[model samples]
Target: MNKPVPPHAPLLEYYEAPAKRSDFVRNLFNRTAESYDGINAAFALGSGPWYRRRALRQAGLAPGARTLDVAIGTGLVAREAAAILGGTRDLVGLDLSEGMLAVARRQLGLTLVQARAEALPFADASFDFVSMGYALRHVADLSALFGEFRRVLRPGGRVLVLEIARPEGRLAHALLRGYMGAVVPALSRLSGRESATLMRYYWDTIEACVPPAEIIARLGEAGLAQVGCATELGMMRAYSARCPG
Candidate 1:
């Protein structure tokens, strides 16, 4: 059985801790889908799309590789991947929110299916690359989700994940917290309720998330090899690992 969202941490537990965590997260994303990319762009200071593009390049994603992007909200990562692929037809996107997938469809015109990460519907050894961007915190069970990644990806397939991390060092950390906890939400007040709520949730999740070391260890446990990580400005994290041949 899939694990329930861990209750050990108050901040990470989630705001809508009702029903299954997956359902609540899905509903939240669906409700926020229309404004999702805009909110991301705001906090990313208009560099969200560019960051995704560069991060995908760093992840070594190449054109013509069969790719599956899990929890690909609004195709943020898929769009970058599509740019490298010359078209979107070769990439498949999976997400739990139809609302988000609808936006993704409009954005990229790629194949998309509504599905959870822990219980992927694809057959084993089906993909050359699998990526999940900015949605690891929303998953109820990291192990199950990564296991699904291992199962679906063909041998030698690579996995990439991009997420914002709590900054290291006292001053940078404090500044980031101020931006996420204060400035972002304050700015969101002008943006809309969806943006504000999403920004708050962003703070909570980033603050209470598992540390980068532990995430790397979990990736190892989930059967990925040669695991490695990179951080930008001590906040943006990029994780890469590969399925063993």
Candidate 2:
């Protein structure tokens, strides 16, 4: 049975799905492109960049490796990975959002491509590392996206996906819900940025998203090996998987 579509998926809520998701997400990020990094920092309690760096390190990024950062909004993860990999590696950013990529270009001058994760415009076995940062819930199909990750990865390549998971304990869950659902939006509004809607959507999507076990199963189904998750503070999760030769 197909999983019922989550209510707060920006794509399903604002537009018809599967076809309109790409456009809706692209436009949504475009609308918040300039302030994305700031919004992320605010929402994640100023640890967003640190989390990206830690995730890349945990994913075993090597020096001089070819990396493709999918949904590389404003180059958040890509920037951290590049800096960690000595800032001279061949790194590129891909996304459906021109506005976001434009900000990334201005920020880092990376090779940015406007494309969808479900249909990556790259050759097979092209990259040693593939990373997507905090955009998993926005995808139309996790299976298809993970399959693309495997297709574009060379043998022995790794994939890292960072996402915000709902907290486990009742107190933690309540705090997380209040923080993301109310505090972040209030902060966004106070800051005079139009990202309050996006913040609310993020919290709802994170809370309604599939569990980590299902994500790991999909990674295996996509032919990825050594699938695992490193969860932090009972809320943030980094999924690490590898392509077998």
Candidate 3:
């Protein structure tokens, strides 16, 4: 069996055992759930919603497609998807955090399920498209997540994963590190210490995440074809692929 693709190396500062990762993440997100959207808007300079919608469109999300937004945090991506689908009737949002799901429930009229990305509760061939936004770095294993995405998708269904990647250019890397590492956390302090900690952890995960090539390869390994990645602003990546027909 191929080794699992962990999003990043474990941060010992947060938790001691790898098995404890889910608990740690759940607690952190629960603590920061209320302020998540505000912090994201401030960090993204208010471009998050527009960018998410455009990326979904670019990845071929269409009206009437049965879509599942995995790891859908606070409905940031799901809301945009609903707009494209003309309503929430064809959309479902799933996340591991109940607190995040609660916030998303209030914001979106779609079906919301509390679940992990690696183990979706739905039956096979349940969706035409699967999307995950920003929360790719939070999953325990990319292979399991992608496998579940493929299993839940009908033949020829598409998958789109949105993430923040470390830039290759020296200047771009430095600038992003400064803004995400220092500036965002500093601004998040207005919300609370947990929010600031979440932002800091967010940047750390981006910096430590596996490369895009690994992600693309793993998608292929998961039996998804036509895997490709589109980069925006040197830091944002939209990984797309399709289940074989």
Candidate 4:
């Protein structure tokens, strides 16, 4: 039999208790870090790296730039950003889970910090790019997170937020939901309990997200310019914007 659903934490207080429901993610990733690439490939159908590449490319990094990957679960996006910047750039992977960072550190050999998205320890204007992959939906205020991203980015730098967007067309929406709610979880369950928990959490969170246009507006309010979005595979999207120079 399946486990009972845990009590829901208030959305506004998500950061206050990051581990209550999310510990599963951290512990799962930590234990399965070695097999993360394989797992993602199976679940994402080899499109995981493609999504990361698309998101990193949108950051438009100049050579030798510094970028921050917030909530960088296993440094997948950070590694791609490093490659996009030609390996001369600084890629900092930050997350609240030490277990996740442990895998990230070993896999990418990049700097990893255990920190929450709401309170990055870096100083103002510390990064040329700030990236978050599938992170915004779980947080409390999208606007607040954008504000933090803006604060850490240098003028002319950008924020790249890659997320599961609300599908555009009716047919596409139904198809994507079927994939996420049905196909993805069924495939993931074979990976075991941790995988099941992650799928459950992520599926629930993605379904609860605001539209891409709303996300663009929030980035604009956070002081980013040229805010834009690119959707792919119908459900996923990469939102990009620049700080005023």
* 68 Cα displacement, candidate 1 (Å): 0.5
Give one digit per residue, the lDDT tens place, for model 4 in 1-245: 32322222343322345445355445545665555555575556334776688667756855678888898877777777877877723888888777777777777867788876877899999998888877676555576678889999999998788777657789977876777767776777677756655665566666666666677887888788999887777776778899999
Poorly placed runs, candidate 4 (over 4 Å): 1-35
Query: Cα deviation in Å at residue 146, candidate 1?
Result: 0.8
TM-score, prediction 1 = 0.92
lDDT of 1 by residue, 1-245 (tens): 65543312544355545445667677778888888877776677333768877877777788878999999899888888898778886799999999999999898888899888889999999988888888888877778878899999899998998877787799988988898888988787676876687788878788888888878887898899989998877888889999999
Best model number under TM-score: 3
Ranking by lDDT: 3, 2, 1, 4
TM-scores across all candidates? 0.92, 0.91, 0.97, 0.84
Runs in model 3 deviating more than 4 A are 45-47
Model 1 lDDT, residue 43, Cα:
74
Model 4: pairs clashing at backbone N, Cα or C within 3 Å = none
Clash pairs (backbone) in predicted model 3? none
The best-first sequence of candidates by TM-score reads 3, 1, 2, 4
RMSD of each: 2.3, 2.6, 1.2, 6.1
Candidate 4 vs. true structure, TM-score: 0.84
In order, candidate lDDTs are 0.82, 0.83, 0.91, 0.72
Task: Estimate, for each residue in 1-245, the C-alpha lDDT of model 2 and write its tens digit.
Answer: 44533223444565676577667667878898887777777787434677778789889897878999999988878889998778734898899888888888888866888888889999999999999988999887887889899999999999999888888799999998999999998887754555887787778788888888888888998899999999878877889999998
